[model samples]
Target: MSETGRLAVRKTYKLFVGGAFPRSESGRSYVVSSSKGDFLANAARASRKDARDAVVAARKAFPGWSGATPYNRGQILYRVAEMMEGRRAQFVAEVVDADGVSARKAGELVDAAVDRLVWYAGWSDKIGAIQGAANPVAGPYFNLSTAEPTGVVAVVAPPFGPLLGLVSVVAPVIVTGNTCVVVASERAPLPSITLAEVLATSDLPGGVVNILTGHTGELAPWLAGHMDVNGIDLTGCDPDLARTCEQEAAENLKRVLRPAKTDWLADPGLDRMTTFLETKTVWHPVGI
Candidate 1:
């Protein structure tokens, strides 16, 4: 048989949960198309049950991931950046198809995404010092406050700039000790799942970051309403959907980040990583 007669091995795109690739429990899939309406592939349409399972996985992984030293988490995240660098070509190709841009433009987005990861990774160990404070009290006591992770967070990635937006949102949450269940951009999810493959191979523990593809409006509500979830970021949600999710999240008093005008290419600063964090303060009487 001639080498040219070989059949290509098609990829089965599925949900990334608990560090393993699994088909959606509902056994449902939807056709994914390029920006030009060309057939790209089929992606799993995650159901409510899948979202629940992802939250459970995140809760289970929280203790260890959160307890690891800040420096350690930063190193692991930096490793993921390294892996992404190795797969630069593949990411650029997917970004081009997903974002409907020329190869050169896609390459730039991919480069920005990789640099974004490193930026967040560098912040992992330094967040506490920057965000924490030492109080000046009237009494003979010492007071200090430091930031801590708010447990499992649900994220809705922005619909545009799939790779860059996704990286911008996810990197900040996990780099600061929070585990996340991200509902990827339905319109441009190919690069997201490919990112999951990179995370799975990295030193990151399972469930630290889970990616789900489906109707954003469908998944965001359940995550917002989930009692176990500590926060919700609606940067990707449309106004109506964001409103609905915000209402649901209020039931548990979850920290809700409403959609805002964001230029992903601009300087991000520290807001994204700080959004999902909580402050802890301690006081001690002065010692002789």
Candidate 2:
């Protein structure tokens, strides 16, 4: 067929769960628009039920993913960067439409997102070395402690810098073998689903990172209070919402990273990765 005769494929933005794109079980979608209020596309408005389903998928995926070697996980993350490179144009366009930034600025954001993935990938295999230590116990035993993943995490991605911020939050969580359910920027969620496409095809296992598009206020409470979730990052919530989520999270003693003034462009320290990690110590007889 001639090029002109072919059709341009249309994408229906849907919730990314279990490595597959599924519309919200509630069968509802909201109109996504540009910063100037121009219509862009319709996106699935995920419900609390969807949040639970994502958590289930994340919990199911945790064992295998956490069991994999850090080097293997790093390689998979590098693969995600490669995939993002291939879809640069789409991501840049989405960022432009979502944030009303110039093409060049969007391009820079896309580049940073790719680089951020690579940066976290490099840390994957080295985290243990930097964070683990040998205890100086006064006994004939070798006492060693190392960082381990904190199981399934719930994240509220920053409302700004949809692509870079989303990548910043999600990459670190998964790089250390923790699976996550993220609520993307409610104002500019288009780039998130596009990112999910990159993850789905980049050899990443299903359910390692599930993204939901909708109101953070509607979803944060349920994710925070869920008994099965091990941590919640309130990076996107306002003070009031963060307080509510924190209270809910306290019910299960979920490890919570409180909302902070974050400069997305600044050097992201080790906190994001370390925040979702727990230390495991082992003791062995010195001579045995």
Candidate 3:
């Protein structure tokens, strides 16, 4: 294999929608260059139809995926880590090429990304409890609160660390049973596309984690204000642009995660998890 890793992707990369790869309905393809300015491939410029199709796919796949047992989701996430391990070399190579980093640093970044997924996978079964609590009520009613996935999440990944940043944001959303519509890094679409390949081969259900690669300024607003999108992770956005997205997201009362300046390459604890999760309360009569 050419050290950059071998994926079953196309020579001319296309948009992956509804579990099948299709060329842009607009029949327009944009040149995607590597971070090093090397010609990567011509990526399809997704149309409004494509975005709508992605939402449809995500909606169709939501219930089953979100309803799956947390343990099962954890197992699947662990499986992704395993699969990624087998392909670590490829990711490392790609990261090295794309970021113009040395092989050692590349390996570290890839390891961070994989480790992130593994961390979030473990949280799959634990987050519901950690972020949850029993509410004290004045009445004789049970008010136990637990966290649930915030439904379809729209993630505009940070521009710098495409691989790790995207994984850091997207994995947490789905690990807790929320589906996602991601606008991957514009400058580094290949790695995101490569992630799609990984998710496809791994146990992640389609639509649960849809990936889109296009202009951030163009796609971020639509994703933010999309009626179907319930939450958003604005981690990858520019400062002023993030404010705009946050404002638009409020139009639908979409849950918004403000941009964090913390080091995402480091381990992200439950802080990130609790931010987007919703507290669900279940009540039962203890009286017999």
Q: How well does candidate 3 match the true structure in TM-score terms? A: 0.92
lDDT of 2 at 91: 95
Clashing pairs in 2: none
The alpha-carbon deviation from the true structure for residue 136 of candidate 3, after best TM-score superposition, in angstroms, is: 4.5
Give the per-residue lDDT of model 2 (tens digit) for 1-288.
457997767788999999999999999888999998998889999999999999999999999999999999999999999999999999999999999999999999999999999999999999999999999999999999999999999999999999999999999999999999999999899999999999999989999999999988999999999999999999999999999999999998999999899888789999999999999999998884
- Between candidates 1 and 2, name the one with more favorable TM-score: 1
Candidate 2 versus the native: TM-score? 0.96
Kindly report the root-mean-square deviation of model 2 from the true structure over all alpha carbons: 2.2
Give the candidate number with the greatest TM-score: 1
Q: For candidate 1, write residues 97-211 as lDDT tens digits.
A: 8878999999989899999999999999999999999999899999999999999999999999899999999999999899999999999888899999999999999999999
Each model's lDDT comes to: 0.93, 0.95, 0.81
Q: Order of all candidates by TM-score, from best down to worst?
A: 1, 2, 3
TM-score of every model?
A: 0.97, 0.96, 0.92
RMSD of 1: 1.6
Count of steric clashes across candidates, in order: 0, 0, 2
Who is ahead in TM-score, 1 or 3?
1
